[model samples]
Target: MEVIRNLVQSLVIIIILAMFLEMLLPAGQMRAYVKMVMGLLVIIAVIQAVGSMARWSFEEIPALVAGTGDGGGQLPEILEAGKRISARQQELGIEQYRQGLAQQVTALVKLNQGLPLLDVEVSVESDSGSPDFGQVKEIILTVSDNPKQTSPAPGGTEPVEEVSPVTVQIGSSETPEREEAVPPQAAAGIVDVLTNFYNIQPEQVIIIYR
Candidate 1:
Protein backbone atom coordinates (compact mmCIF):
# COMPACT_ATOMS: atom_id res chain seq x y z
CA MET A 1 0.00 0.00 0.00
CA GLU A 2 2.82 2.41 0.90
CA VAL A 3 4.62 1.43 -2.30
CA ILE A 4 1.55 2.27 -4.37
CA ARG A 5 1.20 5.59 -2.62
CA ASN A 6 4.87 6.53 -3.16
CA LEU A 7 4.73 5.44 -6.79
CA VAL A 8 1.64 7.62 -7.38
CA GLN A 9 3.29 10.57 -5.64
CA SER A 10 6.43 10.25 -7.79
CA LEU A 11 4.40 9.92 -10.99
CA VAL A 12 2.36 13.02 -10.11
CA ILE A 13 5.52 15.07 -9.59
CA ILE A 14 7.03 13.84 -12.88
CA ILE A 15 3.87 14.62 -14.79
CA ILE A 16 3.63 18.13 -13.33
CA LEU A 17 7.26 18.79 -14.31
CA ALA A 18 6.71 17.39 -17.81
CA MET A 19 3.58 19.52 -18.34
CA PHE A 20 5.50 22.68 -17.44
CA LEU A 21 8.17 21.69 -19.96
CA GLU A 22 5.50 21.08 -22.62
CA MET A 23 4.11 24.62 -22.16
CA LEU A 24 7.61 26.11 -22.61
CA LEU A 25 8.29 24.01 -25.74
CA PRO A 26 7.37 25.33 -29.23
CA ALA A 27 3.81 24.42 -30.31
CA GLY A 28 4.01 21.18 -32.39
CA GLN A 29 2.63 17.59 -32.68
CA MET A 30 5.31 16.48 -30.20
CA ARG A 31 3.95 18.98 -27.66
CA ALA A 32 0.49 17.56 -28.12
CA TYR A 33 1.69 13.96 -27.38
CA VAL A 34 3.60 15.18 -24.34
CA LYS A 35 0.54 17.04 -23.02
CA MET A 36 -1.63 13.92 -23.50
CA VAL A 37 0.77 11.65 -21.56
CA MET A 38 1.12 14.22 -18.79
CA GLY A 39 -2.68 14.53 -18.40
CA LEU A 40 -3.06 10.70 -18.31
CA LEU A 41 -0.29 10.33 -15.73
CA VAL A 42 -1.84 13.03 -13.55
CA ILE A 43 -5.20 11.29 -13.57
CA ILE A 44 -3.70 7.90 -12.73
CA ALA A 45 -1.62 9.45 -9.96
CA VAL A 46 -4.64 11.17 -8.37
CA ILE A 47 -6.72 7.95 -8.49
CA GLN A 48 -4.02 5.85 -6.88
CA ALA A 49 -3.32 8.48 -4.24
CA VAL A 50 -6.97 8.58 -3.28
CA GLY A 51 -7.19 4.76 -3.08
CA SER A 52 -4.08 4.66 -0.87
CA MET A 53 -5.41 7.33 1.46
CA ALA A 54 -8.73 5.48 1.87
CA ARG A 55 -7.02 2.17 2.59
CA TRP A 56 -4.50 3.62 5.11
CA SER A 57 -4.39 1.70 8.39
CA PHE A 58 -4.92 3.41 11.74
CA GLU A 59 -1.58 2.04 13.00
CA GLU A 60 0.23 3.94 10.23
CA ILE A 61 -1.11 7.36 11.20
CA PRO A 62 1.64 8.04 13.77
CA ALA A 63 4.43 7.03 11.40
CA LEU A 64 2.88 9.02 8.56
CA VAL A 65 2.72 12.10 10.75
CA ALA A 66 6.31 11.55 11.92
CA GLY A 67 7.50 11.21 8.27
CA THR A 68 9.54 8.09 9.00
CA GLY A 69 10.64 5.46 6.47
CA ASP A 70 7.68 3.86 4.66
CA GLY A 71 5.24 5.38 7.24
CA GLY A 72 4.59 1.77 8.43
CA GLY A 73 5.37 -0.66 11.27
CA GLN A 74 7.91 -2.67 9.24
CA LEU A 75 10.91 -1.06 10.93
CA PRO A 76 10.94 -3.67 13.71
CA GLU A 77 11.15 -6.49 11.17
CA ILE A 78 14.01 -4.77 9.41
CA LEU A 79 15.86 -4.27 12.72
CA GLU A 80 15.38 -7.95 13.64
CA ALA A 81 16.77 -9.03 10.27
CA GLY A 82 19.79 -6.76 10.82
CA LYS A 83 20.43 -8.37 14.24
CA ARG A 84 20.35 -11.86 12.74
CA ILE A 85 22.84 -10.84 10.06
CA SER A 86 25.15 -9.40 12.71
CA ALA A 87 25.01 -12.62 14.79
CA ARG A 88 25.77 -14.73 11.72
CA GLN A 89 28.79 -12.54 10.96
CA GLN A 90 30.09 -13.05 14.53
CA GLU A 91 29.77 -16.83 14.20
CA LEU A 92 31.72 -16.78 10.94
CA GLY A 93 34.44 -14.69 12.56
CA ILE A 94 34.85 -17.18 15.44
CA GLU A 95 35.09 -20.11 13.03
CA GLN A 96 37.76 -18.32 11.00
CA TYR A 97 39.73 -17.59 14.19
CA ARG A 98 39.73 -21.28 15.15
CA GLN A 99 40.90 -22.34 11.71
CA GLY A 100 43.69 -19.73 11.74
CA LEU A 101 44.92 -20.92 15.18
CA ALA A 102 45.04 -24.52 13.96
CA GLN A 103 47.09 -23.51 10.92
CA GLN A 104 49.53 -21.49 13.08
CA VAL A 105 50.18 -24.50 15.37
CA THR A 106 50.86 -26.76 12.36
CA ALA A 107 53.36 -24.28 10.88
CA LEU A 108 55.16 -23.83 14.22
CA VAL A 109 55.56 -27.58 14.68
CA LYS A 110 57.04 -28.03 11.20
CA LEU A 111 59.45 -25.13 11.76
CA ASN A 112 60.75 -26.35 15.15
CA GLN A 113 60.95 -30.14 14.63
CA GLY A 114 64.29 -32.12 14.50
CA LEU A 115 66.38 -29.17 15.82
CA PRO A 116 68.80 -29.43 18.79
CA LEU A 117 67.67 -28.11 22.14
CA LEU A 118 70.25 -25.69 23.51
CA ASP A 119 68.67 -25.43 26.99
CA VAL A 120 65.79 -27.39 28.44
CA GLU A 121 63.17 -26.15 30.91
CA VAL A 122 59.98 -28.02 31.69
CA SER A 123 56.72 -27.00 33.42
CA VAL A 124 53.40 -28.80 33.68
CA GLU A 125 49.86 -28.18 34.96
CA SER A 126 46.52 -29.89 34.39
CA ASP A 127 43.57 -28.21 32.74
CA SER A 128 40.96 -26.72 35.08
CA GLY A 129 38.13 -26.30 32.60
CA SER A 130 39.77 -23.18 31.18
CA PRO A 131 40.47 -22.69 27.48
CA ASP A 132 44.22 -22.47 28.19
CA PHE A 133 46.52 -25.36 29.28
CA GLY A 134 47.56 -23.40 32.44
CA GLN A 135 51.28 -23.39 31.57
CA VAL A 136 53.46 -20.30 30.96
CA LYS A 137 56.48 -20.20 28.60
CA GLU A 138 59.33 -17.72 28.20
CA ILE A 139 62.52 -18.29 26.13
CA ILE A 140 65.15 -15.93 24.73
CA LEU A 141 67.26 -17.05 21.76
CA THR A 142 70.71 -15.37 21.95
CA VAL A 143 72.05 -14.44 18.50
CA SER A 144 75.55 -13.14 17.67
CA ASP A 145 77.25 -11.55 14.67
CA ASN A 146 80.73 -12.68 13.38
CA PRO A 147 83.45 -10.02 13.79
CA LYS A 148 86.01 -11.50 11.33
CA GLN A 149 84.52 -9.87 8.19
CA THR A 150 83.94 -6.11 7.79
CA SER A 151 82.60 -4.37 4.67
CA PRO A 152 83.51 -0.71 3.85
CA ALA A 153 80.84 1.96 3.76
CA PRO A 154 80.41 4.76 1.20
CA GLY A 155 81.91 7.27 3.68
CA GLY A 156 85.01 5.05 4.32
CA THR A 157 83.51 3.80 7.62
CA GLU A 158 82.93 0.19 8.70
CA PRO A 159 79.50 -1.29 7.77
CA VAL A 160 77.05 -2.40 10.45
CA GLU A 161 77.19 -6.09 11.47
CA GLU A 162 74.31 -8.45 10.70
CA VAL A 163 73.18 -10.97 13.31
CA SER A 164 72.77 -14.59 12.24
CA PRO A 165 69.29 -16.06 12.39
CA VAL A 166 68.72 -18.52 15.26
CA THR A 167 66.86 -21.78 14.79
CA VAL A 168 64.95 -23.31 17.76
CA GLN A 169 64.48 -27.08 17.76
CA ILE A 170 62.06 -29.02 19.99
CA GLY A 171 63.04 -32.69 20.22
CA SER A 172 60.60 -35.51 19.45
CA SER A 173 59.75 -36.53 23.01
CA GLU A 174 57.10 -38.78 24.51
CA THR A 175 53.46 -37.70 24.09
CA PRO A 176 53.25 -36.47 27.68
CA GLU A 177 56.48 -34.48 27.39
CA ARG A 178 55.56 -32.96 24.06
CA GLU A 179 52.10 -32.16 25.28
CA GLU A 180 53.51 -30.40 28.34
CA ALA A 181 56.60 -28.70 26.85
CA VAL A 182 55.59 -27.74 23.31
CA PRO A 183 52.20 -26.20 24.05
CA PRO A 184 53.22 -23.38 26.40
CA GLN A 185 56.08 -21.99 24.31
CA ALA A 186 54.43 -22.52 20.94
CA ALA A 187 51.15 -21.01 22.10
CA ALA A 188 52.90 -18.03 23.62
CA GLY A 189 54.95 -17.43 20.48
CA ILE A 190 51.90 -17.75 18.28
CA VAL A 191 50.00 -15.22 20.37
CA ASP A 192 52.95 -12.87 20.43
CA VAL A 193 53.36 -12.89 16.66
CA LEU A 194 49.65 -12.53 16.03
CA THR A 195 49.19 -9.70 18.48
CA ASN A 196 52.36 -7.87 17.50
CA PHE A 197 52.05 -8.43 13.75
CA TYR A 198 48.30 -7.93 13.30
CA ASN A 199 47.29 -6.02 16.47
CA ILE A 200 44.67 -8.54 17.49
CA GLN A 201 44.56 -10.43 20.81
CA PRO A 202 43.03 -13.80 20.15
CA GLU A 203 40.49 -15.21 22.60
CA GLN A 204 42.30 -18.54 22.80
CA VAL A 205 44.62 -20.71 20.72
CA ILE A 206 44.74 -24.49 21.49
CA ILE A 207 47.78 -26.55 20.52
CA ILE A 208 46.70 -29.84 18.98
CA TYR A 209 48.74 -33.11 19.24
CA ARG A 210 49.67 -34.71 15.93
Candidate 2:
Protein backbone atom coordinates (compact mmCIF):
# COMPACT_ATOMS: atom_id res chain seq x y z
CA MET A 1 0.00 0.00 0.00
CA GLU A 2 2.75 2.41 0.82
CA VAL A 3 4.53 1.52 -2.44
CA ILE A 4 1.36 2.15 -4.44
CA ARG A 5 0.79 5.46 -2.70
CA ASN A 6 4.34 6.57 -3.47
CA LEU A 7 4.03 5.45 -7.09
CA VAL A 8 0.78 7.37 -7.53
CA GLN A 9 2.35 10.50 -5.97
CA SER A 10 5.32 10.16 -8.36
CA LEU A 11 2.98 9.90 -11.39
CA VAL A 12 1.12 13.00 -10.22
CA ILE A 13 4.37 14.94 -9.81
CA ILE A 14 5.56 13.75 -13.22
CA ILE A 15 2.34 15.02 -14.83
CA ILE A 16 2.64 18.40 -13.09
CA LEU A 17 6.27 18.78 -14.16
CA ALA A 18 5.40 17.87 -17.78
CA MET A 19 2.71 20.50 -17.87
CA PHE A 20 5.07 23.18 -16.49
CA LEU A 21 7.86 22.15 -18.89
CA GLU A 22 5.51 22.38 -21.87
CA MET A 23 4.71 26.04 -21.12
CA LEU A 24 8.32 27.07 -20.48
CA LEU A 25 9.62 25.58 -23.80
CA PRO A 26 9.66 27.84 -26.89
CA ALA A 27 7.79 26.44 -29.96
CA GLY A 28 10.50 24.22 -31.63
CA GLN A 29 11.66 20.54 -32.30
CA MET A 30 13.50 20.52 -28.92
CA ARG A 31 10.11 20.85 -27.15
CA ALA A 32 8.79 17.87 -29.17
CA TYR A 33 11.76 15.73 -28.03
CA VAL A 34 11.24 16.83 -24.42
CA LYS A 35 7.54 15.91 -24.58
CA MET A 36 8.39 12.46 -25.99
CA VAL A 37 10.93 11.80 -23.20
CA MET A 38 8.34 12.79 -20.56
CA GLY A 39 5.79 10.33 -22.06
CA LEU A 40 8.39 7.51 -21.87
CA LEU A 41 9.10 8.35 -18.20
CA VAL A 42 5.37 8.10 -17.40
CA ILE A 43 5.16 4.69 -19.03
CA ILE A 44 8.24 3.43 -17.10
CA ALA A 45 6.75 4.65 -13.77
CA VAL A 46 3.46 2.82 -14.46
CA ILE A 47 5.29 -0.37 -15.42
CA GLN A 48 7.37 -0.30 -12.22
CA ALA A 49 4.20 0.04 -10.08
CA VAL A 50 2.50 -2.85 -11.92
CA GLY A 51 5.61 -5.06 -11.64
CA SER A 52 5.77 -4.64 -7.85
CA MET A 53 2.07 -5.49 -7.52
CA ALA A 54 2.48 -8.61 -9.67
CA ARG A 55 5.51 -9.82 -7.67
CA TRP A 56 3.63 -9.41 -4.37
CA SER A 57 0.38 -11.02 -5.58
CA PHE A 58 1.70 -13.96 -7.61
CA GLU A 59 4.77 -15.02 -5.65
CA GLU A 60 4.70 -13.81 -2.04
CA ILE A 61 0.95 -14.09 -1.45
CA PRO A 62 0.56 -17.67 -2.71
CA ALA A 63 3.65 -18.86 -0.88
CA LEU A 64 2.27 -17.45 2.35
CA VAL A 65 -1.34 -18.64 1.96
CA ALA A 66 -1.07 -22.15 0.49
CA GLY A 67 1.73 -24.61 1.26
CA THR A 68 3.94 -25.90 -1.56
CA GLY A 69 3.73 -29.64 -0.82
CA ASP A 70 1.26 -32.55 -0.82
CA GLY A 71 -1.08 -31.64 2.07
CA GLY A 72 -1.11 -27.89 1.73
CA GLY A 73 1.22 -27.47 4.72
CA GLN A 74 3.87 -29.22 6.79
CA LEU A 75 1.58 -29.25 9.82
CA PRO A 76 -0.87 -31.82 8.41
CA GLU A 77 1.92 -34.19 7.42
CA ILE A 78 3.48 -33.89 10.87
CA LEU A 79 0.13 -34.61 12.51
CA GLU A 80 -0.38 -37.73 10.38
CA ALA A 81 3.07 -39.02 11.29
CA GLY A 82 2.30 -38.41 14.95
CA LYS A 83 -0.95 -40.39 14.66
CA ARG A 84 0.87 -43.38 13.14
CA ILE A 85 3.51 -43.30 15.86
CA SER A 86 0.83 -43.11 18.54
CA ALA A 87 -0.95 -46.16 17.13
CA ARG A 88 2.26 -48.22 16.98
CA GLN A 89 3.14 -47.21 20.53
CA GLN A 90 -0.27 -48.41 21.74
CA GLU A 91 0.23 -51.82 20.10
CA LEU A 92 3.64 -52.21 21.70
CA GLY A 93 2.21 -51.20 25.07
CA ILE A 94 -0.54 -53.84 24.91
CA GLU A 95 1.96 -56.58 23.99
CA GLN A 96 4.22 -55.62 26.89
CA TYR A 97 1.27 -55.67 29.28
CA ARG A 98 0.28 -59.19 28.24
CA GLN A 99 3.87 -60.41 28.53
CA GLY A 100 4.26 -58.90 31.99
CA LEU A 101 1.06 -60.54 33.22
CA ALA A 102 2.15 -63.94 31.93
CA GLN A 103 5.57 -63.61 33.55
CA GLN A 104 4.13 -62.66 36.94
CA VAL A 105 1.69 -65.59 36.93
CA THR A 106 4.43 -68.03 35.91
CA ALA A 107 6.76 -66.81 38.66
CA LEU A 108 4.06 -67.00 41.32
CA VAL A 109 2.94 -70.47 40.27
CA LYS A 110 6.52 -71.81 40.26
CA LEU A 111 7.21 -70.41 43.72
CA ASN A 112 4.06 -72.07 45.15
CA GLN A 113 4.29 -75.49 43.42
CA GLY A 114 3.58 -78.03 46.20
CA LEU A 115 5.61 -80.99 47.46
CA PRO A 116 6.49 -82.95 44.21
CA LEU A 117 6.08 -79.81 42.15
CA LEU A 118 4.57 -79.89 38.67
CA ASP A 119 6.12 -78.00 35.76
CA VAL A 120 3.72 -75.24 34.73
CA GLU A 121 3.30 -72.64 32.01
CA VAL A 122 0.92 -69.67 32.30
CA SER A 123 -0.74 -67.51 29.68
CA VAL A 124 -2.92 -64.43 30.11
CA GLU A 125 -5.50 -63.01 27.75
CA SER A 126 -6.91 -59.51 27.51
CA ASP A 127 -10.05 -58.27 25.81
CA SER A 128 -9.25 -57.78 22.12
CA GLY A 129 -11.32 -54.63 21.87
CA SER A 130 -10.16 -53.09 25.12
CA PRO A 131 -7.40 -50.47 25.00
CA ASP A 132 -6.73 -50.80 28.72
CA PHE A 133 -4.56 -53.91 28.71
CA GLY A 134 -4.51 -54.19 32.50
CA GLN A 135 -8.05 -55.59 32.32
CA VAL A 136 -7.32 -59.31 32.07
CA LYS A 137 -10.31 -61.23 30.78
CA GLU A 138 -9.05 -64.82 30.77
CA ILE A 139 -6.19 -66.98 32.02
CA ILE A 140 -4.85 -70.29 30.67
CA LEU A 141 -2.40 -72.77 32.20
CA THR A 142 -0.63 -76.01 31.25
CA VAL A 143 0.92 -78.27 33.86
CA SER A 144 3.02 -81.40 33.54
CA ASP A 145 2.04 -84.57 35.48
CA ASN A 146 5.48 -85.90 36.45
CA PRO A 147 8.05 -83.93 38.43
CA LYS A 148 11.52 -84.35 36.81
CA GLN A 149 14.48 -83.30 38.93
CA THR A 150 16.63 -80.51 37.49
CA SER A 151 20.12 -79.34 38.45
CA PRO A 152 20.20 -75.64 39.33
CA ALA A 153 21.74 -73.35 36.69
CA PRO A 154 24.70 -71.16 37.60
CA GLY A 155 22.75 -67.92 37.63
CA GLY A 156 19.17 -68.99 36.84
CA THR A 157 16.59 -71.69 37.49
CA GLU A 158 16.99 -74.74 35.24
CA PRO A 159 14.16 -75.72 32.92
CA VAL A 160 12.06 -78.63 34.12
CA GLU A 161 11.98 -81.77 31.96
CA GLU A 162 8.73 -83.55 31.05
CA VAL A 163 8.95 -87.23 31.95
CA SER A 164 6.49 -90.09 32.35
CA PRO A 165 6.02 -91.93 35.67
CA VAL A 166 8.49 -94.75 36.20
CA THR A 167 7.87 -98.38 37.22
CA VAL A 168 9.69 -100.06 40.13
CA GLN A 169 10.30 -103.88 40.14
CA ILE A 170 9.73 -105.79 43.41
CA GLY A 171 10.48 -109.43 44.16
CA SER A 172 8.07 -111.65 42.13
CA SER A 173 5.95 -108.57 41.21
CA GLU A 174 6.06 -105.20 39.41
CA THR A 175 4.71 -102.02 41.00
CA PRO A 176 3.80 -99.15 38.63
CA GLU A 177 3.38 -95.77 40.37
CA ARG A 178 1.65 -93.36 37.99
CA GLU A 179 2.18 -89.63 38.52
CA GLU A 180 -1.01 -87.83 39.50
CA ALA A 181 -2.44 -84.82 37.75
CA VAL A 182 -2.51 -81.47 39.49
CA PRO A 183 -4.95 -81.52 42.41
CA PRO A 184 -8.28 -79.67 42.46
CA GLN A 185 -7.15 -77.72 45.50
CA ALA A 186 -4.08 -76.45 43.61
CA ALA A 187 -6.24 -75.37 40.67
CA ALA A 188 -8.52 -73.51 43.04
CA GLY A 189 -5.51 -71.87 44.62
CA ILE A 190 -4.44 -70.51 41.19
CA VAL A 191 -7.88 -69.03 40.67
CA ASP A 192 -7.78 -67.50 44.10
CA VAL A 193 -4.39 -65.93 43.51
CA LEU A 194 -5.57 -64.16 40.39
CA THR A 195 -8.87 -63.20 41.94
CA ASN A 196 -7.40 -61.81 45.16
CA PHE A 197 -4.34 -60.09 43.75
CA TYR A 198 -5.30 -59.10 40.24
CA ASN A 199 -9.08 -58.79 40.54
CA ILE A 200 -9.76 -61.64 38.12
CA GLN A 201 -12.70 -64.04 38.27
CA PRO A 202 -12.51 -67.76 38.96
CA GLU A 203 -14.67 -68.63 35.99
CA GLN A 204 -12.28 -66.81 33.70
CA VAL A 205 -9.43 -69.16 34.53
CA ILE A 206 -8.88 -72.30 32.44
CA ILE A 207 -6.45 -75.12 33.21
CA ILE A 208 -5.93 -76.83 29.88
CA TYR A 209 -3.43 -79.43 31.05
CA ARG A 210 -2.84 -80.51 34.65
- Runs of candidate 2 with Cα error greater than 4 angstroms are 1-73, 114-133, 149-175
| Model 2 / residue 10 / CA error / Å | 45
Q: How far in Å is the alpha carbon of 169 misplaced in model 2?
A: 4.4
Please list all clashing residue pairs in model 2, or write none if there are none. none
Q: Write the per-residue lDDT of candidate 1 for residues 1-210, one digit (tens) a residue.
A: 666668677767866776676678657777777777767877777777666666665456545544454666476665665666666776666556545554453344336441112212222222335465433222222111222223242367654555545555689554432113333454456556544543444533232222
Per-residue alpha-carbon lDDT of model 2 for 80-180, expressed as tens digits?
66666667787788778777777677766666754233333334444446584457777676655544433233477766566665556567475565655
Q: Which parts of model 1 have CA positions greater than 4 angstroms off?
A: 1-74, 112-210
Q: What is the C-alpha lDDT of each candidate?
A: 0.48, 0.63
User: In the order shown, what is each candidate's alpha-carbon RMSD?
Assistant: 17.3, 16.4
TM-score of decoy 1: 0.27
